[model samples]
Structure formats: structure tokens, C-alpha cells
Target: MSFSTQVKNELCRAAMHRPCCIRAEAYGALLHATIFSHREIRLNTENAEIARRLQLLLRRAFSVDCAPRQAGSKIQLVLEHAEQLGHIFDALGYDLKNHVTYHINRNVLEEDCCIAAFLRGVFLMAGTVAGPDKKSHLELKTARHSLAGEETSLLLDLHLSPKMTRRGSTYVLYFKDGASIEDFLTSIGAPRAAMELMEAKVEKTLRNTINRQVNCETANMVKAADASARQVAAIQRVLRTHGEAFFPERLRETVRLRLAYPTDSLAELAARFDPPISKPGLSHRLKKITELSAAEEE
Candidate 1:
């Protein structure tokens, strides 16, 4: 399934309680997530107005600000208003903090339908050709590590003038025939090994994103739990700060576990029990004793 579709399904599952609110929120959130995941904002031929359209769409969707710039011939897009964008994607179940945009490109050789199909949609613009024309003279060549250079060489070989285009602010190869030099790779028998390596790189990038997102979620949970524990600890610390007063045997054991292994989780502390205690049992016992001690003081 497409990432967007999977996200929609997940959102629907999560919103069984309030379908209407989820529908509205999920639409906006999905849009934000997809846009943020895009490595670059590209436009060609009829898509020349894409930058302007996206900026306006973002303004409407997010009610957040955006800025555009031109450095020489290249147009730059900056997301000046990230707060709402961040919030929206977060709500959509994407860990935006762990998501990062990275560049991925590969020269195509030998018309793989999968690749050809991917690029056809990728390069499609407002008025561009619906798909590749079989009669086009351009052919793709296999050249690894130098997408721009390989493209430049291929165009030079074909006696086509290099028409430069920007993938966002970065310059990439384009040709007068309304297709990128990358469009020619498959026609020239580019190496399969090179293409496989490119695929590997992209796979690694996706895996890293998955791992980072999981880690971020785990870290956030730990931080929240720790904050609650620290608040209770702070009160106890104040009570016991001045001098070591004798706590009841049970309370002493609880206090000892809390002190000796300050960073250990409640479960780990419980496991240290001569007869292992359940986390809830340890917690309840500690709470009751603390209350009793507070009552004695009062």
C-alpha cells in the first residue's frame, strides 16, 4: 500500500470513537506529513507554478507562514512556520522529530517497468507529457555516483544542450526534450549492480527512520514516567533531607531501593525483593507507609 493509504487506514482505526473529527484532522495531517517527507519541491514544464501553488496550499492548510527565495536561477523554499506543521504530522501518527528528508536518485538502464512507472508519475507536471514517448531519441545510460555528471555526459554524447533545473534549490539535469537526463539511463544499458546499490541506500534510509521513530517514542514515554516519579521523590527528599530518621522496616526497604538504585525502574527494584514483589505491590506499600509517616509528623 502507498504510505498515504496506510496512514489513512491507521488514522481510521485510531478514530473509531470520533470518526468525524479524525476525518477532518487526518486529512490535514496527512497532507502535512506527505509534503514534509518530500525531499525536494520540484517543478517542470507546466509545473513551473508549483512552488507558488505549494506555498499557497501550505498557507491554507496549516495557516502557517512560508518563504520563497531565488538564489541566482534557483528558487529556494523554506518552511518558516514549522510549529503547526509539526503538530499536524505528530497528530497523524508520524514522529516528525525523527523524520528527516534525504536525497535519493538513481540512473535507470533497461526499462524496468517498476522504475519507469515510478518516474512517469514523478516527472509528470501540469502540462507535461502523460508518459514517455517510445519515439523519443533520448536513451538512459548506467553511471554510478555522479547523477549530474553522468547526465551531463549522456546529454553531451547525444548532442543535446543541457537545460538545468532545480530540485528545490539544488541544480539537477534536464534536457530540451521535456525529460530529465535521468530519463535516458535505461535506454543506454546502465549497470544493474549500480541500481541495486541505490535501492539499498534508500532502504537503509527508510529503516533508519523507522528505528529513530521507535526510539523517540520510547524516550518520550520514559521522560514522562520519570517526571512523575521525580515529583514524588522531591517531596520525600524534603521530608528526609535534614537527618536520617528511622523509617519502619517496610518503608526502610522501599527507601533503600529508591536510593540505592535511583535510576532503576520500579520493576527492576521489585525484582531485587527476596521474594519478588509485583510493581503494584511495591508501589502501594511505599505509598501507604509514606502516608502513615506524614500522619505521624502532623
Candidate 2:
């Protein structure tokens, strides 16, 4: 299943409690549902779990029953009856006779618990969050711009900032940063998904770090091997161009060590000396041998 669906399913398992919070959640769902009006109300979902949750919300919040009208995978809880619509509308503080405003009534979300529940409803109806494997993003899309603006304010009140944009007739409120997405998910009753997102981000960062470290180490080894090859070639030139007698005893010993251990690192070759020398001392001797070899070539 998609990450968004997984979160919704987890949220559906939450026990129905507190009549006010349940009403707030239903209000959010209704406001963002595919079609919510005095004439008809419809909550649409492809997931059977969410469809069931919506049906339960309508019943619990308004004492109204709405069975799923299923056509393939798309499930809809539809209410065309005025009495049922009135039941939901009255619970959300709306009058049956008036036009419904495309905005949130902040008064209905007085408590923090109600605010969270309301956000939960909004997400179930119109929201989607990218999975851990994808870029960090979470969005709520509704038909009206004014409702999006109002929801933006509601999110900000909870210390979470979301930007607003429009696509065709839909107004979108979205969080782009991982931190914001995590917080939003946790706030809307999906802590497991939030933690998974954070874990994925951490694993990705760690893999990148290990890759860079390995590349750097490989580059350094190549550099050291190239330097060793050049040193060995210069030593060979000194031996071939000028005989062993051409060097003093100390330099001759260094030449013998180089010829014997062409692949040994400077530190390893230095330790093989009759009386071991420091790596810097061995490097200085090699440099002198190269100079002598160049002099012979000239």
C-alpha cells in the first residue's frame, strides 16, 4: 500500500472518543470532501478502510448513517437527504438554511485535541504525503482557495508552517521540508509514518557519507601508489646508468632496499633499514638518489 494509505489505516484504528473532537474531525472531512453542500454531501475514497472510517464518522458525529456506494475501487459515502445533511451541518455549527462558507470556523477548534482531530479529518479526505523513498512532501488539496487559506492559518497556530498554491480549481496547502512534514504527520495522528520518514532520511545520509569516504581513501591510495612507482623508476635509472660502486655505502644500502622492495611503502621500507630510519629520513635519501641519477643523465 502507499504511505498515505498506510497512515490513514493506522488513524482509522484510533478509538472514537470525545463527541466534540469527533465532530471537529467530521467537520474537517466534510469541508474537504469531493462534494459538500446543502444539496448533497459526498466523501470519496479508493481505500475501503477510509470509506468505512468516513461512514463511522458521519454516524458518530451527527447520528446519521451513510453506507458506501461502491463502484470498483472507488468508494463514496453519499448523503442527498436534507435531514441527514442538516444533522452534520448543525453539529459543525452551520445552519441548514444558509450557504456554507469555504473557510474553517476556528471557534469549533477551541481545544488542541479538537484541532488535531480536525486536521486528521482533513488529511483523510484530501491529503497525501510522499513515502520515505520519495522526496519529503505532504499536501492537502481542496476545491476552494479560501478553505486552504484558513487551513494554513490553523496549521501555523500549531507551530507548523505550510505554503499555499493552486492547481486548476484545487487549492493546495503543502509542507516541503522534511522537518515540517514529520511534524505535520505526527500532529495528524501518524507518528509511525513520521518516524519511518526520519529513518529513511538518516539511512540515505549515512550511505552518502560512506560513499564519499571510500572514494577519498581510494584516491589517496592511487596517489601513494603513483608516487611509489616514480620513486622505483628513478632508482632503476640510477642503477642502470651508473653502477653500484658510483654510490657511497649509505646510498648503496638505500639502493639495495629499493631494488629488493619495489612495492613497499616508504614507512615499511624505512623499517627494513639495518638501523631503522624515520619515514622522512628514508624520503630524503630517495630524493638524493633521484638527484644523483639526474646528474648522471646530464
Candidate 3:
């Protein structure tokens, strides 16, 4: 299953025996579902776990039994009966006959646990999270603009800064950063999914570090090889134009070492001297040889 599905399944198993928490969760689910109003209450989901959870929440919160039906790959839990809808609205503290527009009822979410349950319900209805291997994105989509705005406020009240945008006909409340997504998943009772996101972040960071180190080492080797080749060429030029006997003793010794080990790096060549020289000292001798060879060519 996808990571999002796993998160929802984990949330579905959260214990909900408190009456206030149950009502809060059911209120959130109905508000974010496919259709929720005075006349009709419909919830649709492709996830079996979410469909099952919604049905259970409705029954447990209001003592109403409503079963979900499978249509192709999607499962839908629909409540169309006026009396049943009225009962649900009554339990959620909404006046079904008078209420036209839906806004989050903050009074229902007085406690932290109630808020968490409400958010859990919202996720089960319309939430999605990208796998950490891809990108850190968690969004709740709704067609009702007012409900979206209210949900954004609710998230802000909980100290989460969610970005809002419109996608086609839907309003989206989303979190992009990994830390925010992790906290969101944990808040909604999906600790395991949050932990997985953290692990993915650590793995990605480690891989990037290793790649940079390897690239640095490869570049150093290339630079060292290029310098050795140039020094060898300069030494060869001196040997051809001016015989070895014409050079000073130290210059002759440097030329002999360069010609003998054309592939050795400056540090490696320096180590071969009777009393080892520093890399900078060996580089100075090579520079003199190159200058003299250039003068001869000119």
C-alpha cells in the first residue's frame, strides 16, 4: 500500500471512546466529505480503511448504523434520510433546518485531544501525503471555500502554518516542509508514518554527503595528474635542448626525478628525495624548469 494509505489505516485504529472527541471527529469528517449539508451527507473514498472508519465513527458518535457500498474501486458511505441527517446534525450541535453554510464549530474542539480527533477525521476524508522518497507534501482538499478557510484557521490555532491555494474547483490546505509534515502526521495519530519521513530525510542527507566527498576526491586526483604531466613535459624539453650536464646539480636532480617518475604527484616525488622536501618546495623547482624551457623555446 502507499504511505498515505498506511497513515490513514494507522489513524483509523486510534481509540475514540470520549463523547466529545467522537463528535468532533465526526463533525470534521462530515464537513470535509464529498457532500455534507442539511439535506444530504455523503462520504466517498477509495480506501477501504477510511470508508470503514467513517461508518464506524458515524455509528459510534450518533448511534446510527450506515453501511458503505462499493462502486467500482471506490467505497461510498451515504446518509440521505432526513430524520437520520437531522439526528446527526443535532449530535454535532448544528441546526439542520436553518444552517446553510458550514464552518468549523470551535466549541466542539475545546481540548487538544478533540482537535487531534477532528484533524484525524479531516485527513480520512480528503487528506493525502506524498512519500518522503518523492517530496514532503501533505494536503487536505475541499470544494467548499468557507470550510477551507475555517480549516486553515484551525490549523493555525494549533501552531501549524499551512499554505492555501486553489486547484481547479478545490481549495487545498497544504504543508511542504518535512518538519511540518512530520508534526502533522504525528498530530493526527500517525507516529509510524512520521518516523518513516524522518528516516527518509536522514538517508537522503547521508547520500548527498557521500556523493560530495567522492566528487572532491576525484577532482583532486585529476588536478594532481595534470600537474605531473605538465612537469614531465617541461623536464623533457630541457633535456632535449640543453644536455643534463649543462644544468645545476639541484636542477639536474629535479629533472632526473621528474623523468624517472612522470606519473608521481608532487608529494610522492618529494618523498623520494634523500631528505624529503615539502610539496611547495618541489613545486618551486618545477616552476623554475618550466620558465627556463619557455625561454629556450622563445
Q: Cα deviation in Å at residue 100, candidate 1?
A: 49
Q: What is the TM-score of each candidate against the true structure?
A: 0.33, 0.86, 0.83
lDDT of 1: 0.42
1-298 per-residue lDDT for model 1 (tens digits): 4222222222223212232332233232222222344232222121224344334434544454555456566454555335755754443344566653222222222223323222222222111211222222222221122443544543455454555455553444444342333233322222232243345556767999999999998997698468447635643664575333555656667766666676676678789877889999987866765565565557
What is the lDDT of every predicted structure here? Answer: 0.42, 0.87, 0.86
Pick the winner on lDDT between candidates 1 and 2.
Answer: 2
| Candidate 1 weakest ten by summed lDDT | 124-133
Order candidates by lDDT, high to low: 2, 3, 1
Q: Clashing residue pairs, candidate 2?
A: none
| Pairs with backbone N, CA or C atoms under 3 Å apart (clashes), candidate 1 | 108-186, 109-186, 110-186, 139-184, 140-184, 140-185, 140-187, 140-188, 141-185, 142-190
Model 2 misplacement above 4 A: 244-298
Between prediction 2 and prediction 3, the one with superior TM-score is 2
Clashing pairs in 3: none
Query: Tens-digit lDDT track for model 2 on 35-142?
Result: 888899978889898888888888898999989989677998889999988887887788779888777878789988888899999999888989999988999998
